[model samples]
Target: MLEHELVFALREIALLGGILGDVELSSSELGGILGISQQTASRRILELEEAGYIQRKPGVKKQLIHVTESGSERIKAEKEKYERIFEMGSRMRFSGTVISGMGEGRYYISQPGYTLHFRSALGFEPYPGTFNMQLNGAELNKLNILRNREGYTIPEFSTGDRTFGSVRFFRAEISGEPCGVVLPLRGHHKGVLEVIAGENMRQKLNLRDGDEARLTVFLDR
Candidate 1:
């Protein structure tokens, strides 16, 4: 479907609760919402239904419309693309002190399953450990916003009954070195940010426990 049609028709339907359940509305009502003619709205709805993006049941003056699973997926994919476009060239700053972790970073980063994706996505093999940072007040808020944005994702994998959670990484630079900000989907650290790089960040950046670290995260490649 055309981009504008998807944005104007399918997106509006989903927002009006069509994705969760059937929504009752007439072509005139949808046209009012879309600022288009009723004839156009009616045609768009028919097109959407024919494309398998929605199921429409006709009624006397209104119709029951429900967005299909395919429609939801299309909306989600479009949303992600828009998110990336919105964040392109944007920068987020982080100021925190180096901290100790529970030694889980090494174990998780060293796994071949995770490392393979890191190499492919981030353009380098990650070191076997993560550089942990204890984020401060404002930086923690920034991290929360970053979490909502789409980034490179390492999907969940399993090995011998053990399943690993997905991880998202944003391209970043720390002290003039290329790096990545890692956020594990199943992590418990609410105020901590883990950093990964091709080399040992602690030694390369000359960082120690309680030392201040600053990172600049770029939203795009």
Candidate 2:
């Protein structure tokens, strides 16, 4: 495996470029971000472009750089490895404030395909509704950590009207109650986490909107 710092440098450059994936970076500026000399930064950029991790385009002013799909995959793989190492040594904790969802969870969780998978993988039938929570503070970072873990996959299946995308479930303990955290691979929610249990978690835990909840996720090695 390549060094993590190099992967991090690539990921940071991607983030700097935003959604358009076009970023203007000079050797000096890149050097400042990476804490290296301008010459070193220039060489690193050339090396990455040659390695097909990024593409560089000469511009009138600063050069335009875009991270390629290969670069994104490399960073993602490194993140997964990092999370595995983290989970091995520490108990992952997630903290968020209760929030409302778009009422889609009930419909989705109630689907026969999803229900069947939930029962089989999680060892319990999930409640129809999901307890949604908006991540706070560093919880968003922790959510990214959860994203890296390999979870039980609920495969996509077609219904009479439409098809539902696959969802991943990870084992978690919500306020000491065993539960499962669900993450849709393709969904609208970004910083929000949806949790499910055998019963309505709100009623079982006596939770309401604005209440803060913490979950200790047990990730498999």
Candidate 3:
């Protein structure tokens, strides 16, 4: 859905208890609340229902409306955007335990297509591998919030009949060492983060499996 529609119409419905439970209101009443005409309010409701953001059951006088799970997720995404806007210029810290990866990071990061862009955009040649981390619930939520913000983009490239997907990365520091938090545009794993640095982070930092590491991500206004 469009941003304005989500911000005004859907937000108004969610504020009217649609997110928690069913909300019964007629188009006229919704229009009065939104300061729009009854026809416009009804169209907005239809648009939301068609987009799978809401479920509506028509009644004689009012309609029983409930926000779907997808709708709740959209609202959460919008909330994250606002949070990032207000928290700009602040450093976001995430703590996680070092973990083992499936060796995919080694293969992908070693590719010349990705390595060239990583070096140019991140200002460092990656160590041909990644430092994997397993994040907790709170840290995962913070990561999700960062995902919604704009970050450095590595465009997709083709190499020898194979196509590599794009990536998004945010500049970060671990123990005051410059690094990046890499997020694959495709095949992303939940609750897991892959970090890239110029050198082997484990050796440089003397880290081991299950060691707690803190990353400080800089945010711009």
Q: If ranked by TM-score, best first, what sequence of candidates would result? A: 2, 1, 3
How do the residues 126-163 of candidate 1 rate in per-residue lDDT, one tens digit apiece? 98889989998776888877787778878889999699
Could you tell me which 10 consecutive residues in candidate 1 have the lowest summed lDDT? 80-89
TM-score of 2: 0.58
- Superpose all Cα atoms of candidate 2 onto the true structure and report the RMSD in Å to 1 decimal: 15.7
Q: Sorted by lDDT, highest first, which candidate order results?
A: 1, 3, 2
Alpha-carbon runs more than 4 Å astray in model 3: 1-90
Best by lDDT: 1
Cα-based TM-score, every candidate:
0.58, 0.58, 0.57
Instruction: Kindly list the per-residue Cα lDDT of model 2 for residues 1-221, writing each as its tens digit.
Output: 24565676787798797225779889899999989889988888887887788888987899999888888788778777678665653457777899888898899899998888878767888889999989977668877777767778778999999998888788778877878888888756579988888888888989899999888777762
Query: Which segments of model 2 are wrong by more than 4 Å?
Result: 1-91
Q: What lDDT would each prediction earn against the true structure?
A: 0.85, 0.81, 0.83
Model 3 clash pairs are none
Runs of candidate 1 with Cα error greater than 4 angstroms are 1-89
The per-residue C-alpha lDDT of model 3 at residue 126 equals 90
